[model samples]
Target chain A: MHLVGLQAENFRNFSTVQLSFAKHTNLITGSNGSGKSNLIELIYYALFSRSFKTSEDMNLLHWKESYLRTQIEFQRDGVDKTVVVSFNSNKEKKVLLNNIPEKFSVLFRESSVIVFSPSTSQLVKGLPSVRRKWLDRILVRVDREFTSILYSYQQTLRNRNALIKRKLIQKEDYDLYDLLTTNLVSLSSLIRKGRQDLIKMINAVISPTVSKMDLPMFSSIELKYYHSRMMEDPSLLAKEEIKRGGTLIGAHLDQIEIFHGDASVRDFSSEGEQKLISFCLKLCEFDLIQVKTKNSPVCLIDDLFSELDEDRAQLLFKYVSSVSQTIFTDLTGRLIEADKVIPLTREENTICLP
Target chain B: MYEFTPSYLKAVEELHQLPGIGPKSAEKLAASFLKMKQEDFHGFVEALQELREKVKQCSRCYNLAESELCLICSDPERDQTKLCVVEESKDLVAIEKTGAYNGLYHVLQGVLKPIEGIQSNKIRLKELFHRLQHESFQEIILATNFNYEGELTAMYIVKELKNSSLTISRLASGLPMGSDIEFADQLTLKNAFRGREKFSEEMI
Candidate 1:
């Protein structure tokens, strides 16, 4: 499934927009700060209900505005569908599918997207949690059980912690503990499996993308999970819990190390290299998800053109175009392929800007 | 700061504060209350107030019970030899719904989360292990929701119970990974039961 058109109102700086899309490649062009990133942010919000740039909802609703709204039109299996989503500080967010109220998950079923943005620079060079999260999100998209497991894991952690704080020693708490461990072991085993499979997938794609881009071989682009959990008694990690004041064992604390051959990429890589590594990972994601879901994701390559030089821009475009429908945004017209440009315009009063 | 009549408007304001209750829902609820006869409204208020006071946690299993022990714990016909442990009364309800396992139950008042400053000394771990020491149960079934924190809690209990003579086994493969038995489909629950396998004889 792919987003074919987008509409926005009081969403970030856009205030108003109605842009057409291309089947293979669509280019969004404008000056810097003229709502290019805002447009991409709107698409991300409409799809994921979160922003890559900012966590604060106030900033996204436009200055002094109380609400933000986005509407995206997508095509799936030859059927055109409309999904409208909006939120106000005063109310719960609302979603409508083709004018009918529907569950939020319904807004994204089988609808896949692979996105690359400046914030993604941290995927390779930042923290373990970032890479782990990147791993889980992709797995969750194709594997519903992973998402549910993660949700339960988070909630169980909260509930378990509450018991610890209250010092409430009811017999049932032990029973709960038993339940928690059994689930954690089973789910973590699966998560470990998914990651193992993902690492192999990443290994398979990263090299080819690097070769295709003609960039220096990133021997540093390696994903190494702290492999101790597989060997160490998970119970030992549990024993450490008394000292750590929580469950110190398993995937929650296990760190995944990334390297460019012998050098620690986290310390040695340039920001541009980090971006390249992250972009390569996103492409790897597209390949893996496509293989699993059998559908090319709607690719949203946001502002990568502004960050890369002409050579990198051409390479990035070349790679992104090989799979999926992509809508890329650029500040200067240079990023716009002469043959494929979709201008953003609003009539006198379609969706007025804040 | 906004002007409002005490009787009608205050109720509307308060009702609107509840989640999923927008201004329209708040107005509707308040209006529904007003439409109720005085006797009916009194009955509703009394029922709401006593909802928690009436039902209490079972002393044996921690499931909400009208009496000292819940139906599951109090049932003499149950196989005391098998114990299915869970994290909440909700989990107990889930297991009970299947009607496939005729066993006893123990509910952990909560799970273990150190980040929130929770410790094992606080929950029902000691009580559970203490019971296992005296009871000649054949097996302890770990049926907790599968997730990161739940796994830690489950492992700790299994480790503690390792000293006991009872067989320690986790509920099986078919419950669909990462979900609570409460949310598991009936087929999956049946499969989990059918797939039940021992963790290790050494633990027992």
Candidate 2:
């Protein structure tokens, strides 16, 4: 499914706005605080029902505005539908699909979108857990069955940690330790293999994309999945964990390593390079989902042009423009071309196509 | 250092014995008890006392109950011949939550924790054995936790019951009730598959 039109009401700097979209690419251009990124976030909220940058839905509401709303229109299976969401004083919200009330989760699988924000730069260089999350979220989205296993594994980790702490406080509580150790070993091992499989799939897509970007001649790009504890027995680790306040030897501590040639890219990669790697990795994920689900996702880019230098800018513009339905934002209006532009004019409280 | 009546001291002592509750919480609870209306404190004591006075472990299954036997065991509609053995009362509750197992259950009450002063005799094992003699059980499926103590307890029971003609089995582990093949840990899955027994008359 692809967005045919988007409207913003009292979100961030936009008081009210409406614009049409192209099936292939739609670029949104405006100045800083012109409500460009806010426009992209609005689209993301409609699709994923989540804010990428902040936890508070109030942040999504326009300043000094207690209520906000968004109306989005898209096409799925050759049928047109509309989804609307309104935020009120109690932070209560309602979702309507094609003018009919619908649950938010039901709206999820029908359409998918990959967001590239400044925060996403951390996917590559921030932490191993971050990269692993990048792996599982896509897997969970396309394959719902994986979500349970992922959740079970997480619960098992928490239970194990609680047992370890209890074991430490009461030296006689070896049974709890044994139980937690066995579980930590069994479930953590499973999570590791899951990560390895995802890493392999991600590499299949990232390898070419990284090669396409062609880093500096001396620089090399590598994405490695590392599971150090997978080789060690979980029970043995549990016995040793008594000394440690927490069990750090399982999937809880599992790290995926990213390298640029001989050096660790997490430490050495430039800011722009981190963004590029993360972008390519996510695009690889975008492709992986398409290959698995046979449906291309809607792509959303928030203030993408400002984050990318001219060289990287052209690459992002070229790539995002190729997606099924893409919406891009920028502080400067002259960047990538969109079939439609909804300018957040200073004079108007709402958005209107410029 | 202040003095307290026996009823007030009981509240402090009970609160202090609970997990994570410190002396501060115990003192707070005692003060709260004082702040409560006399009738309210009496009602709180009655409810707490009822939990201790009324709840009893089933003679057959070790499940907590308001009577001599647990509701599951006392319910005449349940199949007495099929006994599902679990490591603890908690496991029994977990199985009961599914509403899947309609047969009688034998809660070990504890596992074979040799280090914890709990031997096979410490739990309700002897009662379970006696129940087996009186009942014509066709099967005793082990539904223990998927952990070391659980597995060890299961193995001990299976070995002890090997001479009997009754069917003994373990829960399937390949995939949790609702899980996919894609996300399963490779090793856990491999072990699960390896542990899978052939479906046949004797095996069943």
Candidate 3:
């Protein structure tokens, strides 16, 4: 699937903007603060029904505007599809797929996108929790039942924590605590298994993608998952849990580590290595989503050219555009080989395709 | 700004206090009341008055009733040896509509929600245990909603009755009838797989 065109109204700094995209490569060029990234965000919001930058839907609205709307037209399997999303000040969200109303989650099933922004490097540079959450987010799209299992695990963990917080466990409460622990243990196992399988898939795709870019340093990259603790001795932690007034062992504290030839990337990798690994991980995500959903995902690259050298940037662009339709935001319009370029000027409310 | 009459405003306020009726809906309902015929309006008022005055909690099972016992509890046709426990009178009503259950019911009024300070004592668990001891029951079906608190309450009740001779069971939760298996959510599919019934048993 590929994005064909996009339009937005009263979103952030864009009062109104419309532009068409090419099937292979599209470069969005603009000076600083020219709403270049905003255009990418509009497409992302239309497909994902949420913004990667802002968690609050209210922030998407243009200043002095009470509502925001975005429409994206894409082609999948030789059929054109349109998705329209609108949000109002009342916190109401509505999505229309092919001109029919649908829930926000339908976007995930209908289309997929893998985003690589400057912050994507955090997967290698940030805390373990960041990597864990990223895994969960990707799994939610690839595996349908993963969301339910994760939700159940979190709920069971919270309830168990609340029970422990009561301090004094009554004689009759033993059975309830045991039951909660059993449920938590089983759900935790499901979650751990899901993460393990995802990492295996990522590991499989990461190697070929990494090699495609000819990054010999990352030829042996692997993603490893570390469970918080073995569920066998949950009883051993009961006392510690009661004292701490919360849970200590479960998927909630699981860690994910990315390694390059037995060396942890987060610990030993340079800034350039980290960025390239993040890019490869996103490419794996693109391949996984494409295989799982049977539709190629539109790759969204936001403000990432500046972080890498010009040579690596060109290679990244060539590989991504070849695999899937890619839309990249460039500061100086350096990648002049793109099939189409949409230039934006500061204070311009309209985008004319060139 | 134009102001409504004192009585009209009061009517709107009262209507707004009811569940699901917002200020705008309340104003519309109050205006509709003005257009109602005298006798029709009187009948509506009489019905509300009767509901408040006559409706009472069943002394036996805590289901809504107009007498000492709920209709189900007073009925001779219901199975006296089996009891189905629910979290509220509304849940009991829903089950009754199915006509699949011929047994009596016990409404707990609420579930155990420790996070919200709703402990065992806040609901009707004590009354349930008291009924179980006094009344001869062969089985008890815990029919709570399939949520965290409801499941916890059902498990707690089972633990309390661990030594009892009565057969205790929980409602089977999984895919809805006639739903396509492909469209079923993962959690429901997991449950359906776990609770798959034996074909031999069904054949018999």
Candidate 4:
């Protein structure tokens, strides 16, 4: 599957836009405030029916505009398809697939995209919850059951915590508490098993995959999934949880640690190493999605090439171009071997990408 | 503020207090009422007054009714030995429309959402237990929505009835007939995948 064209109206800084992409490497080059990131966000929003840049759809509207619309035309297995997304000031969102109004998941399930931005480095350098969310997003896309299980797990955690907070929970409430506890343990076990299998898959390919791409700085990566102290039996911590007035055990508290040879990447890796690791993880994610869905996801590389040194950037460009259709946004128009270049320049309210 | 008549504005305000009516919808509805004939207007008012004054919950099942026993409970043909428990009267009505279940129903009015301060006692669980103890029922079907809270409530009831000899079952969750696998939502698809049934020639 590949994106062929896009048409956006009253979206971000662009009042109207009609643009198309090459099937292979395409670079969107522009200076600051020229709607490079906005164009990327438009495609992401059209596919996912939500913005990756902002949580609110209102933020994507043009200045003083009442509505915003985007049309994304892509080719899947040599068959042309169109996805249109529109939002109004009333927070009403409408999605059309091939001109037929459909639910958001219809568009979401039709395609897969792997986005790599500078913020993706947070998966390694930030909190454990960020890493957990990253893992969960990939798992949900691959395993349909993971979404419901994870949702049930979170809800069970909240209900259990609420039960713990009840000051009048008598001895009779033990049955309810035990029910919640047993459910929590079983659900956590499922989640931890999914995360472990994914981590194992990534570790099995991280070194060989990056080495093949010639990015040796990240050729020795390993991911370790860690469960909380009470994985099998959360009831062991029931007393402490009640005393703390919240949950103290489950997948919500689980963590994943990344290693580079013998050093912990969370604490010891420099910014460059962290970013490289993030890039390598994105590559593994691309491969995993391809193997699972039998469709190569279009890669949205946002201003990531600019963050790397020129030597690394050149190597990464060669590797990225060989993978699949990739759209890279960069500040400088120095990617000489790109299949197409879109230079975006902005007037007051419109973006001209000629 | 717009110089609408006092009575019209008052009607609009009352309509706006309803669940889904906005200020504009309430105004439109009140204006439509102004366009009605005098007898129709009187009929509408009389119906609203009667609804407020006459409708009472069924004493046995907590369903909205005009008497102590709901129409279903008073009916002699319904399977009295089989009882279906639901979170609301509307669900029972939906099941009745299907003509698939010929049984009595007990409405709990709500489910157990302890996070929102809705405990088991907040609903009709005590009444349901009392009815179960005193009445003879061969089967009890928990027909709650298949969401997390619904499943939790069903589990709670099952745990409470651990020692009871009654046959307890829950509503089956899966894909609807004629559903396309590509467009199915996550939760429905998940339930369908989890509750997949074995295909047999005899069953077919």
Alpha-carbon local distance difference test for all models? 0.72, 0.73, 0.85, 0.84
True contacts kept of each: 0.12, 0.00, 0.40, 0.44
Docking category of candidate 2: incorrect
TM-score of each: 0.70, 0.66, 0.90, 0.90
Best candidate according to DockQ: 4
Give the alpha carbon lDDT tens digit for every residue of A1-354 in model 2: 688877877877777777778787776666565666777888888665567777788788877888988888888768888888888767898888878887776676667788877877889778777887777778777765566567666655665565565454443345445554565677676766777777777766666665555544322466787665553664566567756856666676767887777788788877767787777777777778778778778888777766767777677667656756777776665756666665565556665653
TM-scores of chain A across the candidates, in order, are 0.86, 0.82, 0.90, 0.89
| Inter-residue clash pairs, candidate 4 | none
Q: Candidate 1 chain B, which ten residues in sequence have the lowest lDDT sum?
A: B114-123
Instruction: List candidate 4 stretches off by more than 4 Å.
Output: A100-106, A161-177, A231-239, A346-348, A352-354, B76-78, B175-204
Scanning candidate 4 chain B in windows of ten residues, the lowest lDDT window is B183-192
What does the lDDT come to for candidate 3? 0.85
Taking the tens digit of each residue's C-alpha lDDT, what string does model 1 give over A254-327? 67777788777778888877777777777778878888888888877778665666787788787768667877
Kindly give the number of clashing pairs for every candidate.
Answer: 33, 7, 0, 0
Candidate 4 residue-wise lDDT, A198-301, digit = tens = 99998988987687557877777899888887744445566677789887878999989999888999899889888878777877888898888888889888
Better of 3 and 4 by DockQ: 4
| Per-residue error (Å), model 2, residue A322 | 2.4
lDDT score at residue A171, model 1, on the 0-100 scale: 49
User: Which candidate leads the pack in lDDT?
Assistant: 3
